[model samples]
Target: MLPRRSRLTGASSSDRGLPNATVARLPLYLRALTQLRSQGSQTCSSDQLAESTGVSSANVRKDLSHLGSHGTRGVGYDVDHLRAEIAQAIGQTQDWNVVLVGAGNLGTALAAYPGFTSRGSRIVAVVDADPARVGEQVGDLSIESIDQLETIITERSVSIAIVATPGQAAQDVADQLVGAGVTSILNLAPVALRVPEGVDVRQVDVAAELQILAYHEQRKGHPREEAEVSR
Candidate 1:
């Protein structure tokens, strides 16, 4: 069970409505802290963390402040305590059972990698439309038919769905997931999804990210000759 936080006066602040930018950078801090913990480090000052993550020390301090974390004057923040607080603020303290909607390449990769679920989210079921892929072994899971989507989701009480289906099939699978009571979706398909009012959807588009990086590179005096090489 997750530890309870008292919302009384002087209690620790929660991450319920953190600014978007701060919330996005929290993962970087978490990763840096995790690395420090693995290295047998005892504690980390803000400057050390800033160097590890390439963020400024002042910015790191400000971000940690949002989580109500105040490092000691000299000794700095305790690595383990800070990690646990950040994890709790991010809701990683609770177990999240996810239903993966597609068993294609992206789905298989996500399923095969246990690191994806090491924190708190676990892919409890894998679903695919292809008969050949169904019943295939992925790690400890056997790919199940798409026909079992509703049953598996409901049985596991899954609230998160990963949509890695083809671009054209994404919306249909998302509709099915919503129908199956999935409130949040991580869509890997290269398409925009339309979900109901309360359902949350996060899309990952590698091509789009590459294009954005290219734009920045061009602005930073990247020569036109580079375009020819890239082409």
Candidate 2:
């Protein structure tokens, strides 16, 4: 984590219990700032960030305010400083050890994706239930059997897991992940997971997201639907 500088303003947003909506947008802002930094940007006004990210300038300022940032009224914010603050608030300052479950195509792609480590997560381990897949290499890590899941997780101090298993196996995999002491899960399979309190589960239902897009597309073609709703 960046050393707490005296120049920084009030308490961080995480400390102040920022709203869920604001917390979600922090990453978007961070990504935009990171891209700007890569492009040789040293300072960024909230309006510039909002414009790049498609968010309103007011919301960009409001969300950043929660993090205790006091940007110069006219000079804008220091890009690197703001990026570090956002990353720190989001716990990306510390490297999070991650474990990937399943060795299927989706899992393979995720394991190979360079973004996770670049964004502060390290894929320490990968596990699969299929014996045939055991010992197979995914990226730099060799796939281990599900039988070793608990042991590997305990030894590596893994706090987060990505589940890319088939829907039928997702629940069982989740149960094992919880039992193995994983605190957070990013489940890609389309299944409702029942996790105990204190455990965070973020589910990504690809089909459901596609369905939502389909709804929007249908409404675009059926303008009468919007007219009826206004009645």
CA lDDT, every model vs. true structure: 0.86, 0.88
User: TM-score for each prediction?
Assistant: 0.86, 0.90
lDDT of 2 by residue, 18-108 (tens): 7778878988998899899999999999999998988899999888877777688779999998998899878898999999998899999
What C-alpha lDDT does candidate 2 achieve relative to the native structure? 0.88
Query: Top lDDT: which candidate number?
Result: 2
After superposing candidate 2, which stretches have Cα over 4 Å from the reference? 1-16, 228-231
Stretches of candidate 1 exceeding 4 Å from the true structure: 1-16, 220-231
User: Which 10 successive residues of model 2 have the least lDDT summed?
Assistant: 1-10
lDDT of 1 by residue, 1-231 (tens): 334333222233444466667677787899899999999997999999999999899989977877777788999999998998788777888889998878888889999887766677899999999989988998789999999999999999898999999999999999999998999999999999999999988889999999999998876776776677878
